[model samples]
Target: MERYVLTVTLNAAVDVAYTVPGFSPGGIHVAAAVRRVAGGKGNNVARVLARLGVRVAATGFAGGAAGRFIQDELRRAGVVPEYVEVAGESRTCYAFTDPETGVVTELRERGPELGPEDVARFKARYDRLLAGAELVTISGSVPPGVEPEIYRYLIERARSCQVRVVLDSSGQPLREALVARPYVVKPNRAELAGWAGRPLETEADVLEAARRMRTAGPEWVLVSLGADGALLVGPDGAGAWRAVPPQVAALNPVGSGDSAVAGLACGLVRGLGPEELLRQAVACGTANARTAGVADVDPAEVERLARRVRVEPV
Candidate 1:
């Protein structure tokens, strides 16, 4: 059976997280809480998708105890990860979520340095996986020694297999991938700004900037705005809209983008249009905001948020 989705997490890691109340520069309060678990961009995405009853396979690199730990954690989460044992151990990402203010501060790793052989090995694995995937999401930054053109390379490879590729990266890596024209590319405001070589100041600016990017080739370009919502540009339709978060206060803001990806990917795999895509995308994002780190959003909550999503097709 052809898999519905395949997620590529090149710079994979085991995320060790914690939380504390009333953080201060030099002192700490007596009361607090802490939690640690496995995490990575694609892993986070797959976790949400699987929890939503979407079958997924997480593919990338891993090594050492940290790598084993992340692999173990993913398996425990019921996520099937095909992790290649790279030369070094997996990296760690730390997040401190403050309950009172709903602020999350993250300390991220630079990630593993891949040799040419390591890159070749991962590429082979990616090729094998693409054969079974209907949609593929290749996200995160480029690791050490990895070429900036890796996204372009992978996007081209996946497309050759008829796999819909989504690129969610920034800087040189994203700029390079534009040349290959993945099926979809999600760049938040700042990232789209850099890619446009200017400041994306207004809704018009965002729409126009994305238009210029079409010359670089993605079929759909989605630009996400925190709380404000996202703009979609491409074959299905072009639109601008705002997301109205549910009445409840936001608990945390982590993994919101990945949630959007899962929602949109799910719709795409089922042949849904942009209205449906953005509807689910908005709901997923709001659902993410209502939870702690990596914990799933309730489907019923997503349904609630979905009802509030307003899409203005342009």
Candidate 2:
């Protein structure tokens, strides 16, 4: 079997998006467009990875009609689905976009709860998948009945297999996984601030917070700054770089972060230098923002934007 990048989305969902022109509270408005697809942070990353010509597989829990939709969608997107079906139905998350105001309101549902058996089944499947995985990416929230320590266990297993892991999550799961020392941790500004227990107001503040996070366990801390671009702090703490992407008229910023994660994974697999890696990550993110669909980006656009990205040592 060929080694491929593995993406884990524990609480996978069917993402529904509605374009409502004059979206307001307590008002009747006809949606201009409605789109639904398989979505979770990891699934979004998988979609972008496939689009980038990477061999990728997605695993998580899925059930009922929504789960079927998710599996079919992944197949359509050129990603192999390796989900474990549960007794409960998978969730469907809704996002309402107001084109007039350029604002998006989201309503997300907590997916099905997992039992001990379900967890055991998933672990067994994950163990088998890890054998043929060059790298692993775990993203998004866990469903009810699953402990935060699950991420830690997964990271440990992947490490035991000598596979690098890129973790994109928040709260307790993020905190727990850090102890496993994943290769990379990608957190948005707000997520980093939450982990830091303080507000990061300036560039220096953000950099300092990222350094502190590095001490926890992760080899590299990539702090995503919406609009301003991203900051990458290396393992040694001495090497740091800031990537500023070329400005574009952003149509939707929903899954830009996941696209960035996909870019980082691709860079890692390709053995890119730090500067080039940051450029690719920022370019993918910026390109995703140009489209309304989540993680939908053109490779040509990404290449063009990568050339314009400015990366400098900090």
Candidate 3:
């Protein structure tokens, strides 16, 4: 049996991206280009992992025509889709990008609600997948009708199987999952600040907040700072490092964090050290930002960017 990474996106979506030259509110404009793919935080992570030659399987609730599209897209991308079908229709999220201003505006719909039956079916599938999974990534929001404690339950199950989990979420779900002590937790600067209930105004502030989160159970805390890069707090808060990328023009910043999570999972499975891990993670993020589509990174670009990433102990 091949070992693989398992990614869960409970509220999976068909992501649609449109490029408009001068996108402005309240005006009808023609799009220069359009792209659609399977998305949601975990799905993006799965896609990136597959691009990097990692065997990855994606699971969660998928329904309706949109859901079928997502499955087909993932299969075409070399990611195995094992989503549990639900009754409700999956959502379609839209992102409008203005190339002239380098701005992206997004509108996301709350996807199909999952009932107790749906959750039960998913858990059964998840448990079977965990058997072959080297790592698990749980990302994105909890859909309606599912309890926020869902993440906690999932983490506990993964832990029971002795599988390391990489969690990426915010708000109530994040708070609940932290108690389970995931192997890695990736939060953006704003998400960390929200959890800390205080403004993280400086590097020291961010570091302190990340350390505080470590006490909750995670072995590693990674806080992503757009442009400035990411901060990594090691196990037991023994060491902290900041990985900064060389500046590059960003075409789209959406899903960059998911790409970073993919990189982190890859590094962990490869047994990379702290510095190299951060370097690869930051490079994946930076490479994602340079692409017009979400989580679409060139392997050569990722390798090139990794060499330029400066990982400094903080």
- Candidate 1 — worst ten consecutive residues by lDDT sum? 236-245
lDDT of each: 0.79, 0.95, 0.95
Q: How high is each candidate's TM-score?
A: 0.93, 0.99, 0.99
**Higher-TM-score candidate of 1 and 3:** 3
- The RMSD of every model to the true structure, in order and in angstroms, is 2.0, 0.8, 0.8
Kindly report which residue stretches of model 1 are placed more than 4 angstroms away from their true locations once superposed: 29-31, 236-247
Write down the RMSD of candidate 3 (Cα, Å).
0.8
Residue by residue across 1-314, what tens digits does model 3's lDDT show? 98999999999999999999999999999999999999999999999999999999999999999999999999999999999999979999999999999888999999987789999999899999999999999999999999999999999999999999999999999999999999999999999999999999999999999999998889999999989999999876469999999999999998899999999999999999988989999999999999988999998999999999999998
Q: Let me know the TM-score candidate 2 reaches against the reference structure.
A: 0.99
Residue 301 error, candidate 1, Å: 1.7
Q: What ranges in model 2 sit over 4 Å off? A: none
User: What is candidate 1's lDDT per residue for 189-286, written digit by digit as tens?
Assistant: 89899988999889889888887787688888888876877888875345444444455577777788888887777778878877778788878877
